[model samples]
Target: MVTVQAKLIFEGSEDKQRVLDLMRRWSSCMRYAYKRLLEGHKRNELKKQLQGIFNLNSRYVDDAIMKAKSILTSCKERGENPKKVVFGGRQLFEKLQKRHINGKAYKKLQLKWQEKRKGNLYSRGDRSKKGNLNTRIEIDEDCTRLRINVGEREYVYARIQPGWKIKDGRYIDRNQLLEAISICGQPYSVQLKLKSGVVYAYFAIEEVFPQPAITRANGVIGIDTNAYPRHVAWVETDEHGQLLGYGRIPMPELESGSFEKKEYYRWQYAHMIVQMAKEKQKAIVIESLSIKDRGRREDFSGRRSRRIRHYFGYRSLLEKVKLLAKREGIEVIEVNPAYTSVIGMLKYAPQFMVSKDVASSYVIARRGLGLRDRIPHNYMMFLGRLDVNELEELKEYVRKVVKNTYVRKKQLREIGRVIKFLQSLESEAERLSVPLDGTSTGSRGKNHNLWQVLKVAVVTPLSPERVLRDLSVLKSLLVSGQVGKTYKGASSCFLGQGLWLSQIPPAGAGKA
Candidate 1:
């Protein structure tokens, strides 16, 4: 199923007011549903509460609460750590449960949210932003128009102007799409959104999709993402995991850009990579990574800050790739990220004379192909230091971050301090090599290089590598404010919770 979203423009004050009234009522309805959830009221109990509250159909309220619960559930799944559902200013206007298109009963509308009507008519709290009528070019639709069927009292929306500017860089008339929908039957869903008096619409169409057979025949293409020096390293192999080809894809543009602009570019990048996989007739493999944090304490440095922002874009990249691949009938695989980088460096990099990222890509591909127990003995030593003094030192730093006086907003700088300290600690470890055979006492100080010791004592149990991995989780916890007393006492309110942040003067704000 492919979902297409479009921007909408409305004509005439009556038409605009009609859309606004629908949005206002819907928002108010969603707020009510959210409050009921917080109060531990079941759907049936909430349904009863809705019966006498609004003169509108009961299905509207039912849809509101379901959408609210669904949104809340998704947020929780993303590790949002939301203590309460905040229906702040943003209101929801979902597709109605029963809709009528061309007089046939269906579920949804061409346009649709706020609440509370005095008597049977919708109360106009404020209408000072009404505009002047003039000859303006506006996009509108009729056939695909949606009507809210409530017995004999129908709310009909025919044409929504300024339609959608699709991937072709041109506005697609809703009327044209509606004709197509009529032929193809009703879509899966049509969503309405109202923000700052601007209306937006989304249409999701379900179509026949063929299952990807590449994974069954060809192996996967593994991609390793490196943020510090931005690049995507990819390795291609057979279904059984023998490497076939490898290359580094440079990501210089990602290093610096506005968040929105960068996100658009990230989508473009993911699209390009997926196109490569499609052409090769192979499934793609990537690490299952999610970094839902602001930044680590170590991000105070300009370079560290850039790295955090760059890596954060990985989530967006992954999402875009998955969506694009699904639409194209391509298989995408995500494997655990445990030791791909380390294993890549220790086993593949030296053997193939490739960069760490390329080697990591190979490891990621292999891991996806069922080779999980192939770690080199030298790297296994570094993994066995769970009870070492360095770990204690790391814990002390983490505790300091949690106990810091700064608010969550200021924790990035604190994380930077921890990162700086980790760098110094690494230097100290290099200075005091900790011995190779696990037998050198401090008084008998062996002056062997740490990585060199591991190489020569390759058969020795448990060794250390030259580079120390950054404690990313420590930074993530700090950035996400999951470590301490951030957001400990915010109150939840039901009324006036909606926010309209856009200053794009509401329709008629411009002197006509």
Candidate 2:
């Protein structure tokens, strides 16, 4: 469990009064230190000033400084103006600008605002001090209480309400406060938050994940997140790397929404996927995708690429899946997303009559099972037909076609990305044994590196020449009786930039 929330019951009114006073003073100290931090005061400079101004000793003052500096840092990270920021709710504070309330309503709002401004006490935990120093937990078999040391030898006690609560959804975790303190030395932070007038102690503990019961050796579920149609594609596969079943979960919410709304749906979808894995006793496989840096494709300058890159909440969704999977003892495997889309489109989509996204998930699942893909012999033959110098010729021809025959704005933007994608493949081919054609006229080696096969595979599937549409012709032409039967020494064909990108020879090719 990462957190434990148990109500505190004070023994006497005097203890309650003392705790309230400390809370008030602590809030003041933190607010003052926060202002000082805004003025460029260092922690050491503010620490001495805080101790002298407030009744808090050096340790308490230091804690206040830590908390204040964190808030200041948060404001910087989130692009919020620290000067105009309200300690209480910003919305409530802004209400006075337009006279939003009066009389009884105004009094009610004022009370709430004041409560928020001065209703908290926090003490960071220390491992050497056995979990905590200021806010300490004392547990006997019969009784459990919080010992809050105010100063000198004086302290106040708050008896914790004893009972078991559900932890991490299903696990019954008690205030293993005793276990954490005496045995694990797992430091836990405590914050005394006051609501209405009663103080509640909120403890944040390090979550413990269970040992996985279901593993990748049995079976697995592969997941892929998309932005355009807005759905999460999942494919179930057995340990032998064969597809068993698949489904597409609607994610209309990811199209456009608030961060909170998107997060809620991410968790919701993550839970559904994890539950399916548990029911089938299978592991979960996902592409290790990041929002900002999605591996080699980061340099694509297309609008659709940039928008899709930023829009899909891939990282957040993956994190939630991993965390929940760990809690339920479900194993999760992450595979490189580099060419999953192209493989799915070129190989699986035609074979299974599935969407490109679903096909991609299938590839991801197979990859997680330690399966590798070899370039189809015909495709390898077509690659062998093109010499190293022909790389530049083919790229120029495709660029002219794209410029001459464009369609939708979004389509054009995406196709423009293919131009850069080809360039990247070009760069990857250089200065190493980066195999583009490992055929009998082998440029590099007899064996194909996945990335090398990827170089040629990536060029055709994603653009105007849709691989899914031309799969049959592609098979008949490339997979016919001979390796280079149809496309070999092909004459220049009228190839255009838009859809139906018929492969054409570069001008002056016959001379070459």
Candidate 3:
């Protein structure tokens, strides 16, 4: 059977005082029962049974009494009348049954007590002269609205205007009623009512329904998140782990010297990447960064630092991404970012060096770099050994290959251009004493740079002849000093954006 539910709101301080007094009296009754049992009274058998009941009932009485005393004390401390108290009779009864005694006799005893105190129980004092108890209590579907009865030969039941049916069958909390003086605190799932200019609402106590599950697909996408161009890298993979296509989209530039703008763009980029994932029918895999207790330095300092700490809202963005992915039936997975930039570079190194000839070579090379291996360091160390050299000639050659990788080169150019432009704009703005538009300032000029870079990186050599040719190009670029410091800036950008990209897609993909 469906449970019947209703909510009652107190009218004034007198009503509250009455309820508190009742709870205190109830506590006193339990104490008296215990004393009688200890004293070996004539009702010794009854007292013995009541001792068990009193022990169980003491908790409820203590809780109710404490709440009542708290309200009255607060009113007294503030020099206000203690006339209104709100308590759930049904909830109190249920608690008693669950915690104290349950059976026909206990039920009868409860009914008898309520019947005996029908009028004076909640309306005993002068403050209740309006006679609200006789009229105001209300019952409605899912306990959304309340009805009140006020005196003066008039009914004063408070009624909440009906709205949408309560979703997920939850009830409001009693504390919510005591705290909510305005409608803003009302439960979104249920409507509320107010009497004497005070509002009270209730939310369902039941657990919410689980979110719908999403179906799985064979398509997979590797998302490399970055700052200047939020969704910096995207690679589509087929069922057999073949790279079908890959691309990167540059994000709008965030105004320099504006941390808030930077954070806002972070969220925007994350959202756009999630959207892109949905559109492409691909599952997303992202690098996970531990935001809490990760010992990361704050981007801002002083009061600005405090504001960034309090308002950056990365947690909220993560929640949004998860929700969006859930709704769209796309899968999102997180991988450790500890060495992603380095690993990705190594995997795609050959393609960038020879442009078109080494594409297939990198694909085969990357197949062995998966972090899922039981021994990640062993694998990484192996890759490191391939390019490690103390000799200047060999060292330069390896560095060139790593730098020439399609993603690395493109990322380096993007960062250099963006930083240069931002620094230049900052200098100009300082001179002019003007601020640039926060959303309009970044390295979005190279629209096709990401795709071009990937295309250059993915071209594999079909034969050994091509591999040798690509290796020669790698050696030349390294020795000639054509590539500068391995672009660490892009790695930093990816770290920042990775947090935003990790939560995408609605379903879990099969093990990679």
Candidate 4:
């Protein structure tokens, strides 16, 4: 897919006015469509409503509904609240409330806000319609002519010409647009954006480019995206999943910087990763985490909410890498991210002597190669040695905290979740203890999340508070699997009344 931005040349001021009027009407229909769509109205139903409410043809009405539906879908993907969304900038809306301001400045701001509300138009291409039914473009001698259907038979023509865009003191040439539009009868979606009476056209055409000859059968490069101590940990693995090389792509720009700087660095880092994969003739592996599944803003508050919206651009970077990889003909693999960090920290970090993130990439790389992780004998024995009865005592200790502690409602809820999670872990542990005499696979879950059980089992001993974060602790359990006699009472940090008392390693571990 390739998109080019060009300036739409108008023959007269009347033509510009006509486009602006269409944009205003389109925006009005779009808002109505959004309202109806939110009320669970179907696209066909909303289309009928738009045609009756606004002065537009069938194509314009469908486009408005399509655009509105896309916006709603994106909001869902980003976990944004549709109800709290302000059409214009929220800052601009608040500025209108200020009385101590210049009249002209106030009017300019007002105009800008109104423009956002009613200055957008779009139309999807139709191959059967000889390109687009609305913004129809065709070759005209040396240049191309764009014919816009303004009314039920009336039309306006504009010449497609290359334009220059200045950004951060750099001028970007648009000559590629002319080259792209040189071919005729190709379907191209067009979006016209109005700014101070000027119409800028964005032409996007999607085409299936040939896949690169290089393939994933060679090897894989696994990437672990990190926020704090911002950097992307990457590992190059052989086709058999053995680690060959490793490095980190520094991304401090994500920690604190302007949106432009962040965007620039995102591409910079994405290009570097794509180049590495290309040079190694390997496929790229990354987590397939959904943006909407990350967390909702309503579930958190203050800095936590801000972090959900503003923290590391995981989705953005992931998308950038995918785009660049596609263009370079490098294969990109997406693996389930469940417990990759936990498995890495507990199993690979100490064994490989690397940071948690790098270890995570290693696990990811191996997963891409269809390699499965088995629980080490040490941790499995640890679980097998666990006195399942002691978990009940731990729950009792937590119930007392919820009843007597003065923590916030949210914290209490979190503690409740922890208790429930512990109960589930306890059930699994009892199963593990039952098969202490065999090395058969019946000790625990093959259907259940083996890594999740290990996560809870190992994390409880080491930072019991931040169990979910896996904050770089318990990374030494794999170094010397034969070590023993390490035990701590489940009090203090555990917040328990020393109820979780037992031998961490089973006394008869060798027997098992």
Candidate 5:
């Protein structure tokens, strides 16, 4: 699979004229043959018949005419009738043949149509098109020079000023090309031009193979996508419930506050961390967020939420990790994130009242779920089970309470102000002798209307103190509006229920 790419360099003014002239002559001959065929002459017979008229020394022209004859013969043999035989097909055939013949010396010649036709026959209705193939022309490494054979009588070569150095260990080895095809193998080299005014060639050596599998590595890292400060918490676990290492990479803040930049930086950091983890021989685990949901819009009032969503490239990051891990021979697994955050917080930070605990738990939960079920239980089992339905139910309940509390708080504040205004008005009316009745009207610029105080109390009897304390523990959720006011009334009912069944006890306590 020797591949070659080239860009045109200087073709002397005279050489350009000669090339154009040859092209014109070839085109004219093809047109004449096509016209003869359309005028009721047999195309195959006519193409072969005209071969002798031109000097057969021009292999390019001969090859083109031969191809046209082949196409006409193919169509006739297939028992299909074609409209008109055209010259375009011949012109293309000739150009490709010419390129192949010229590039054959460089071992970069790739001709798909050169082989005998197989399976299908050409039809008259098929459009004629030109072939685009890279014509390999080698330049000497010592000096930028190209080798070309012009006419049957002369061998011409041109040299460019100043040689360019190849990059790394890559070099154009004449011996390699001269060797047998099996020994030469595939061409895995790419040409690169550097800013230092030097051109370099890079080749992939066959020595690099997949790294030895790390069978005993029993740890995994979980990553969470964040907005303001993006970080991936690594909760290292062992065979037993012993914490190993916890690491995080804080994304650098963008000066412009562009979330897209933040996402890019986050991905870069994640990529680096993943590589580092692999070097340390740890498997990576990440969330498999739905692409469609990531882009879905919500009727949110905060501009920050919208900005973060719009700029967040979660799908891209996930895809990048998957691809990079595979190439590096490191396993990357996606686990359900239903309540990883909550579980992570419950298991790791029993005393710490931080929103990150939930996020951290989410990462841990995803990794824990990805582990093989047959693996012996240890810190992973303590991380909790991957019960999708239970996690979703808890998340939904938390979200509903948070939303309801937020709406109620706003309503209460507005209603309180309105009540104060009404009370002041009623007092003034009483002092001015205005009737305190709904139908009362007075002539001394006094009118009265009875107003009923609207009772907007929430029906649930919640313990305000407990709710407040829980709210403090969930500051991140509260600030982000992920959780609503703690329903104090609901807390007691939850205590007797299975609310904390999945919750893990503190690090030192027995598993609950």
Candidate 6:
């Protein structure tokens, strides 16, 4: 099933005003339903309450309650502390925004609020100004126009364009009203939204057909999603796990400054993935990543801003891809992500001449194929002798080093400065030479503090070789410019123009 938007044209100012009034009423109904739900009222009871409180049709009241319940349920499922539902507030009427317009207008105040590029929550319309009406609106018998029954024997007829062809063959017109939206199969519900002054009707087209059940596939495409420098590294492999190809799809919205664009691009990217899977006739494999608590961690607090940009939709990609895949008759599989990245980096990256993420994607594909398990022999041996605490300590040290070197370096200049700082810190420590005190003091024994500033001190067991390797990784990251180059005075950022392909090495080449 697919849903498309069919915009409606309101001919007169009064017609537009009437639709706006309907939207306001709808918002009020949603607010009422939400409050009742918070007070422990059941959905059916809330519907009954709305029928008495509002003069809208019974179907409209029921739809309003249903919308509110969906919002409340979604919030609870996400483990969020649902606050008092407010119309035109920061939460943006999660229910009201999506209430059944039933071929009516929906205020685009929230969308405009987002367009300002300001922070979330902006006022577009007052609760008193917006009204909502669901029923009494129907497409004319000829399907060439809409007949909206505003009152007894009183109807507002809006003429609409039949259809307009877009550049990509997708029909969308914000200015012209659409008369009839050619749909495939049967359209179950037609929803309308009025924002600003334009009206858009959404048609939920439901098509039933005999779907062929897919047998076991011989290959799968594995996708590894990264938040920072957002992208999905995908690799295709045979059933036996031998890699056939690899690539990466950069997602610019992960870092896009606009919340609206972030949402739009997220779905756009998901659709692309689903289309790719459909074209290839292969199943999709992805990690069941859960980063709900990522922002709460102290280590992640520094990136809170960037994280917030995409966090709400971090899991949305998976859900969307799965949904589209199901509709397309494509199978999607999830596999354990533990150690896939580690093994991919250490064992497959050099062999395949790909990035760690790409290599991890390869491993993920193979794991989904049930062809790979157990760490390599040497890795297992090393793991056998390492104590749990020692391993954790080493992991922590590496984490701090990488975090300081890569994440912190963004505050300063290129890798050269980083290497210089590490070397100078080492020199300062050597000059002190007397088992420096608990902490190393700077030039004035206080000012230009290296330890505090760098978030790392010249502790023992550090080496130039290690710093060099870290510098090398930092240099590669800087060169790649994973976030993409930014342009001033531009609304959209150029994303992922570069393409990566596996460069299989010679037969006798050294394979790490």
Per-prediction CA RMSD (Å): 20.9, 8.0, 21.4, 6.9, 20.8, 16.0
Work out the TM-score per prediction.
Answer: 0.58, 0.64, 0.35, 0.70, 0.38, 0.54
Best by lDDT: 4
Task: Please identify which of the two predictions, 2 or 4, would achieve the higher TM-score against the true structure.
Answer: 4
What ranges in model 5 sit over 4 Å off?
1-139, 142-212, 239-242, 254-268, 289-306, 310-312, 318-329, 345-512
Ranking by lDDT: 4, 2, 6, 1, 5, 3
Candidate 3 structure quality by residue, lDDT tens digits, 1-512: 11122344455666544433433344444344334433444443443454355332333333323334454558669986544322334454555566466688677656544432231212111122321222232344444333322223434333443233321122345334322322322221222323233333333222223343322255556655443222356666664556677666564444243655555565566667677767766666554545432112433344644444344444444455555565566666655544344324333443344222123222322232342312122221221122112122222332355554543444445333433333443342242232221122235433322222222322221111123233333322223312212343343211122211122111222224
Residues forming the 10-long window of minimal summed lDDT in candidate 4: 436-445
- Candidate that would win on TM-score: 4
Candidate 5 per-residue lDDT, tens place, 201-291, comes to 2222232336535322556556666554544455544433245555565544532465555555645765686676576676666777762
**If ranked by TM-score, best first, what sequence of candidates would result?**
4, 2, 1, 6, 5, 3
> Which pairs of residues collide in model 2?
401-497, 402-497
Q: For every model in order, what is the number of clashing pairs? A: 25, 2, 42, 0, 12, 15
Instruction: Tell me the deviation in Å of residue 393 in model 4.
Output: 9.6
Global fold similarity of model 6 (TM-score):
0.54
lDDT of 2 by residue, 117-222 (tens): 8988889888787688788888778777899887777899998873676433344546564446435677788888887777888777677778898999898999
CA lDDT, every model vs. true structure? 0.52, 0.69, 0.38, 0.70, 0.40, 0.52
Lowest lDDT 10-residue stretch of candidate 3: 499-508
| Cα deviation of 26, candidate 3, in Å | 14
Question: Model 6, stretches more than 4 Å misplaced?
Answer: 1-7, 11-26, 35-53, 71-83, 90-143, 151-155, 161-216, 226-232, 247-280, 289-299, 303-328, 350-354, 385-512
